[model samples]
Target: MEERVKIIEERSLSEGWFNLKEVIYDYTWFNGRVQRQSREVAKKGNYAGILLYNKEKRTVILTRQFRMPSYLNDTSDGFIVEACAGMLDDDAPEECAKREALEETGFKVKNIEKAFEAYTSPGTLSELAHLYVGAYEDDMKVSKGGGADEDEDIEVLEISFTQALEMIKTGEIKDAKTIMLLQYAQINELLN
Candidate 1:
């Protein structure tokens, strides 16, 4: 497939917060036809997310925060329940996951198991997300974590696993990474 895709040109469209680039490329179809196409891609760097679970309590720690994109797209309040996550930004995926977990939920997660890495939106956005499941105990909470900075008005919630799963059915908990991790825990019987 590498031989089938030839990038003819690339131009930077924007470079604030994230990068946007317009790329012109030639693709050779399976039927031996060459097609030229142009596409604009949003380049947000890779990220890491971790689901924190307390087995003894049968609970999961999640965060709720206002997301402008969700609000702009029809989420009534724009708040989403999600796992702790952040950009990798010069840190290893595991380290980034741990950091985000602590910063967002105040849990110093120690036993983290890597689940998988995925492209959140491969069609137009360049973001690869590393997913993990982390175990925590009551003693792990070191602070009242609502995010590190004032701008991040995050609310941490500790809810039973069953309740969280029900939220999925009730049209809540719509964050993709959070849903994936929750389903992974259920399928793997991690809390059991």
Candidate 2:
């Protein structure tokens, strides 16, 4: 096998974003170099969270909201079912996640467990997800959910483990970050 990438030049497209020029080496056929064939988006920053609550009950919380991308993609209500998450801007991953959990769903997490670091779309978008599994006893701490003024129309949904599972199976919870965290929680039996 030959390496498909051999960088010739790199250019910044935006802050924390870039484009790369490379060669496409094929072992079987031929080794050809392509010059700036296309834009390879390289993003540098955390852009997500996947929080888990009620570990004993095997349930997790998620959000239901109108997403413009989904709307353009033909979602019935343009709504995306996802875990509480947001972009991090010069904040610690854990703190950013905790703040997002509170602001998105109103759950003041007592503790947040780091799960894994992953990329949602590596081919184009460099959006990395700083995954976390957090727990909090549903109490008076979270009566006022988040409705931030960042081009977001979020609706919180505290669902049971069973409901979360069903939603996952039915394509209701389709976000990559949410799915990644949920899969870990389910496999580890930590979504109580």
By lDDT, the best candidate is: 1
Candidate 2 residues 1-192, lDDT tens each?
A: 566555555555455233333323323335464434535465555665856568666567788888776788865577888888877888888888888887888778867789999877878666678899887676725656755667667888778877887887998888888888778888877864
TM-score of model 1 vs. true structure: 0.96
Work out how many backbone clashes candidate 2 has: 6
- lDDT of prediction 1: 0.93
TM-score of each: 0.96, 0.78
Q: Which candidate wins on TM-score?
A: 1
The segments of candidate 2 whose C-alpha lies over 4 angstroms from its true place after superposition are 1-36, 40-44
Misplaced by over 4 Å in model 1 are none
Instruction: Give a tens-digit lDDT track for model 1, residues 95-169.
Output: 999999989999998879999998877998999999999989999999888998778999999999999999999
